[model samples]
Target: MSLLRQLWIMVITITLLAFAGSFAVSMLTARNYLEQQLYVQSADNAAALALSMSQQSKDDATAQLMVTALFDSGHFELVRYTDVAGRVVVERANHAMPEGVPVWFMRLFPIHVGAGQAEVSDGWHQAGRVTVLAHSRYAYLSLWAGAFRLLIWILAAGLLAGIVMQLLFRWVRRPIVQMVDQAEAISERRFITITEPRVIELRQVVRAMNTMVARVKTMFAEQAARIEALRSEANRDPLTQLANRNFFMGRLAQALENEEFAPSGCLLLLRIRDLAGINRRLGRERADQFLQFVAGKLASLSADRHDWLLARLNGADFGLLAPGLSADEAPAFARELLENLAELRRIEITDESDLGTFGIAAYRHGDALSTVLTRADQALAQAEETSNAVVLLSDSDTQATLVAHDWHTLLTGALTGEDFLVASFPVLDRNDRLLHRELMLRLCQPDGRLLTAGAFMPHASRLGLMPVLDLETVRLGLVELGRVSYPLAINLSSTSIADSGFVDRLVSLLRQHRDQAGRLWFEVNEFGFRDELRALAAFGERVRPYGCKIGIEHFGRHFGSIPQLYDLQLDYLKIDGSFIQGIDEHPGNQQLIKAIVGIAEGNDMLTIAEGVHDDGEWLVLAELGVQGWTGPAATGRLQG
Candidate 1:
């Protein structure tokens, strides 16, 4: 039972005991007073009657008349007059029950008194003795009336006390409830504090809880800072603060090999002209500052493009990888870079007008990394001959570029038709058991070609059609879930989650399929999630009731904001593929992964590694406490 209920029962019991005691005392006191008054009246009346009889004649007629008159005029149970020798002269008596009083009450508290007696005289001699007794019906009535009044007063007071107790209980309950909530939040890995109550005991409890939460927050903040530092040390270029050559190559390889990555994109290579000559003309410090300035400008230009990868490839060469950029748009992008680099010359950082040369190479999926590098290098050699110092090398068989209107038409037509399809990749546990299949949306053309989400999603987003596509994907996932017994995960775009209407529709769909909702998972990319945390949180809240799971894919890219995840209550994290690539041979990345696993475990979230390509990587990830794995290796194991 709750403490409040126990207290209420105790209060009621004490009130009843108090009422009983008071009633007993009041009834006893009243009965005693009434009994005393009755005795007094009997004695006084008997004395007065005796005197009256003494003053009158002592004859039988006179005595009988006086006795009868006295008995009739006053309340008496019995009245008698006898001669001095003890012979009866005259007698009168009456016996009757009291009215308006309960028999039970009379039996419980019956009034008792002695009858009064006196001597009578006739001509200076005793004629007969007169006796008078007073009835106790009036006394009983007074006692009963006083007892009833006491009971009514007791009842009124009890009611008032009960009301006051209820209000007091409610006031006490509020602070206790707040304390309970704070404790639960802490258990869920969300450190929250409550206001200290005015009550001393409750205030102490709340203060202790707040202090613990503050300490925990500080601990987590320090841990996240350490992990971020590890990430920088492992992947960042020391001088330029851009991704180092190894990290950049690993990310480029993932984009090229991952099926969900963009089908085609552009790679740009920028080389400083005569770096040794500039270093000798200016001091080493001045040349280092110049390099930093160039790196800063490149980072600023790609600040808004989360998909773009900027890296310091070497001391004099920098690389930019732009996914989803077409060959037709490569020249314009290269000219933009050239224009930005011109700022260095105008600021006199270098005397040579031709500060740098640009080489742009367009690449498609399945192309060799070495082949792309060679093409960019050839483009750089050609740019050194050109006056503008910028050249773009394209593949001869590149596909035709689609305009905005054409893309809208294609996507709308495809969505309306039955050409949209979904492809599943298995995510597995360390025991080789299937966790869930991550579903990717695809578009089937009339020519029997499959177009991945990367090929069309950008256009759909631009046309505000992500809500429609995302809802359809959820519907398809539900249908598949009903056909199969296993759970399924689907990706949602940042744009779709930001749209309130889309959230409503998605939640409605999940509600309609409540049984399948538990088996359905929704994930958003970490890049998008960091910017739309509030929107994603609201979306999670709406769908959580249906048992739908929400998570962030491509996790660990923003290690600095891991602490912000306490309030999200996410179900899982899909570590980015770049960090997972060749993790078995990299100790620094292993520590980073271990830290990530610890953080996720602390929050009760599952950590899944993405893009596992070999048994070595899979084994290392499993040893590092990854709960799930999804990639080429995981898919191969599922097939085997």
Candidate 2:
């Protein structure tokens, strides 16, 4: 319990104890006073009665009547006039002393008073001895009332005091609560301080806390400065002052939270396509100069001065957060960013060579910092695989135009107007056998043309609509599967992997079709798996009971961080299209394909090569041990 609560309990206990003590004392005093009053009244009545009887003539009826009257006037338990022979002449009795007070109370604090006796005489002759009994009823009643009144007064005082104490305590604790809150915020790395209280003790405490906070804040500032310096030393290419992996993520996280520094932006994460070969061909120092030159060129061309943050995310990998640019503007910016690097040096390795394995991804507000970075990394893989100068996330006008269009209204319309549709492309084995059909989404527009994801994905991504879209797609796919089951594989975007609602909806959709769920396969992008590994692991466990298989698409692109299959429970991997597109002549491509196939086979996961075009490339991949294929050359229903 808190100190304030303990103090409150103590105060209440003391108040109750004091009230109890006062009540006991009041009751005892009242009882004693009443007993004395009764005894005195009884004794006075007996004496007066005897005197009156003596004054009357002997054997007179009047004297007897006066004595009888005196006895009657005394409200006693019993009153009797007796002769010398002990024969009762006159008698008065009230109901046998009614039990007026509680026995327990009387026992707890018994009050005793001596009975009074008095001698009575008339002129010469002595009157018959008189005895009187006193009833304690009136005394008991008076004492009870007085004691009750005292108790009422004590109770009233206690109530008033309690209210005052409560107000005082609240007043006293208010500053403490504020201080505690300030401390909690500080713990969360938010710098804050509270005003000092007026109370000397509390003021001193607050002052100390403020001093401590100031010191810690200073330390944090120093540490941050040190970290910035170290990052510049350890990770920066030195010439460009661009970050490596260690610095990029920290800077990105800060940018995401800081509105003033980075209002809205995108990151262009790129890699030097083949730095080793460049270093070998052009002496070490020249290659180093080339890298610096490329870095500078990228920095110069990447973003405008308005609000974009560009940096090297890691070795050969670059990132840019271009704030305030819509998806439509990013691809153009990306092309510029990549083309500038090509001007760094003449390509001696090949006359038709590009400068870098430059993957350029664009991010708007509300994108997870980690997700954007991972996606940029994924784009870099594709760039390396495809040998594309730059692969802009917004190159496709579908995503860009949809992003430019009002998405809230469109999504609402699509959801309400039944404009959502799902289509599947078969993931087939080498001999043209269906391994499973990968489900893809298309939005039926008002104009009636089926719109592929490339049409609306960027908008969905920017609007934070991926999770909702993915969930609805799952529901719709389940419905479709019930009608026609063909080993369904549903695609989940990176956003859906970490969303609880998406997982829940998927579970519900599966449960509704329990019998067919076994044939279901859920596919997540490699970038999504890499970004949210924990969420992926949890998602795998959540869906495992349904017997649905989980697979990764665009796999082998992120070559560095291959997650343990034991941890992922993945059933298949779709090798990125870049690796499959032009694989016949490139020995390096053949070697990489062999490594990927070996990794898949070793892990007990089936491998599918996407974007297989020609027979020579297909034959090479088949020889390299790729099990499945999907591309233009593959005889399948593929919408362009």
lDDT of 1 by residue, 1-640 (tens): 9877787787778778888899788888888887788778888887888898788766789888988988887577888887889988778876788789999999988788677888776777766777778888778888889888877887778777877888887887898898888888787767787888888888888899899999988887877787788888887888888887767877887778776677889889989888898899997988898999989888888777778899999999999999888888788877887788789889987776777888988888889888888999999889878655878897754556689999888888887886799999999988989989999899997799998888888778888898899998999999999999999999999899999999988888888899999999899989889889889888888998998888999886643456477778899999988899888988888998898898889889999999899999989998999999988898899999
Clashes of 2: 12
Once superposed on the true structure, which residue ranges of model 2 sit more than 4 Å away at CA? 1-287, 296-405, 636-640
User: Each model's TM-score?
Assistant: 0.92, 0.44
lDDT of each prediction vs. the true structure?
0.85, 0.66
Residue 13 of model 2: what lDDT?
81
